[model samples]
Target: MATLPPGPVRLYGPQFEKDPGALYAEIRRQHGPVAPVLLEGEVPAWFVCGYREVHQVTTDSQLFARDTRRWNAWSQVPQDWPLAAYVVHNPSVMFTEGTEHRRRAGAISDALDAVDQFELSTQCERIADQLIDEFAGTGEADLMAQYAERIPLRAAVAMCGMPTADMPGMVRDLGLSIDSSGQESLDAYGRVQQAMARLVADKRVAPGPDVPSRLLQHPSGLTDDEIVLDLLVVMAAAHQPTTYWIGNTIRLMLTDVRFATTLSGGRASVGQALNEVLWQDTPTQNFIGRFATRDTRLGGQRIRTGDLLVLGLAAANNDPHVRKDAGGAVGNRAQMSFGHGEHGCPYPAPELAEVIARTSIEVLLDRLPDLMLAVPAESLTWRPSIWMRGLTSLPVRFTAV
Candidate 1:
């Protein structure tokens, strides 16, 4: 077995957040496939960066598990620790394993599958146009805050059958949940949970042809708490990643001359640009806390039972073994952005998510064909997160329509 280095590499520092791709390249050069790293809260974990290794860890559920209850950090850390918020043991499908994982995941998948993709696409287009109309007269807007973020929330509200009146608050809570300070994050998480719980109750009392309602009807027999957490999972899964996806793809379209030329010349579609982003810069750069079920060897390193493993989705996607020509793999679906195996993304399958993102982008681009970045690309900043890779803002200017 390869010996782990003496000290854990800090993976959540400002430097790492500033340029993760460079950091990942250095790590791969120094540590091979699986590198030992420390999260922001000094949490020790292994980052699986090799494409084949990530696939093995993600698919071989028997060797590595998604259940946080198996995480050694839970026993070692205090309940009120800031990191505890992320590792909160919930009955949601995101944290389950084996049969329970399948049952809970199936409920979500069926609910999402029941949605009309055409209606969802139309709704996204309508929302995009409406949002664009808010800034059409101004000629300048922060697309990240004004458009990319809001469209997904609105679409999620419509799909989950939540009240539109609660959208502003939901948006605030969701943003806080992702980027807020310590205590504020906890408070924001509480509000989000309460809001989702209320939606569960409302859906139960008056079921509609929405995802939450369909989940309630699933034969999994999930409890009320389970249903609430699962609903939050759906909302988070649908809104945040999708939001980043739109922003990233739009950034690519606006800044990369290659993509701009292809899109303008009709040689490549918006779907193709979106796929390239998924392969090169996935929305969720890294995902949490898979625990080893037993003492095991992975990627030439020893993994103890309950040790944490973070799948480096972005790094794995860029792994040279799997991707020989990263720039040429346009429209490729082999990227691990949506993940793989039994615990892969269950809501808003890759195709449907792409449709929503593409529709929104198409509506905005068609309405303002002259859109260009207001600031230099290097001036833009990324959200400092261990789980997601998102721009803090994307400012753009376009001719008033």
Candidate 2:
């Protein structure tokens, strides 16, 4: 067997920080499924690149613990700083393990069952139509800023029974929190927390039939603060990534001839097409962090207790081991942008696929058939973050429909 790459590549500075897809791709090429990489500072983490290893690491509760508390004390931040605190150890429904996690997952699943997918499809299509109507006359617009980001925010807000008016600012504040790179931005963090707290209070008093209110009313062993955090978590996870995917999809359709051809021909399922977008251009490039609770071996190296492991879901999705369905490559296809295992994103299968499909039907395929990039494709800007991998702006234009 080929010897596993050394302990872990200590990753730092702007280049590695800027775009890790290249680094991850190289690692996968060099080291197969499991490679060691350091995140933040001296944090030793296993980077799993292959689909099988990623599934094993993510689903294996005994070997790797998703709870952030088990790792470093400094990783924990104050609850007042919800974003950082969440990044460290907020204990939202997704991170919990064993029976408690299972129970919470079951509750969320059951609650979601009541939501009508058809209604969701209609709502998403309606939102897409409204956005297109407003911007259609403008002749040009930042696809990411004006459309992609707005739809998901509106959907998430409506689902949580929050006012749509507050969505723009809330989404902006949340974006700032995720974009925090230098000294932690207390102001941005405060704005997000206050907005969430207000929503929590409003939802508690008026208790609408939305996901947030239901979670609060049901009180599944989670406190008011915890419930609010949970809601914020959902918003954070749902909005930006989907927005990024939308922009990326448009970019691919406009630039890649083959991808555009497939969409134009109507040979691909929108769901499958969105999956291709996710695989080819994942919104979040970084893997969810997990700490080792017990001594274990990965990448042919012994990982001691308290060691952190980073599972590169994006990289694994592209791994040779995980074969894509025979259908699509760039546009009309399959991918692992949603992640895998118990904590993997539950939204992508239906919630996400429906949105992308409806949006495609309303916008790219129908409303703006000749949509093309306003600037050279290479001129587009990308947001800098170790977590989310997306373009900052995707300017485009199309012949009036």
lDDT leader:
1
Clashing pairs for predicted structure model 2, backbone only: none
Error of 1 at 122 (Å): 0.8
Give the range of the ten consecutive residues with the poorest summed lDDT in model 1: 260-269
Candidate 2's TM-score: 0.83
> What is the Å distance of residue 278 in model 2 from its true position?
2.2
Worst 10 residues of 2 by lDDT: 76-85
Whole-model alpha-carbon lDDT for candidate 2: 0.68
RMSD over all Cα atoms, model 2 = 4.4
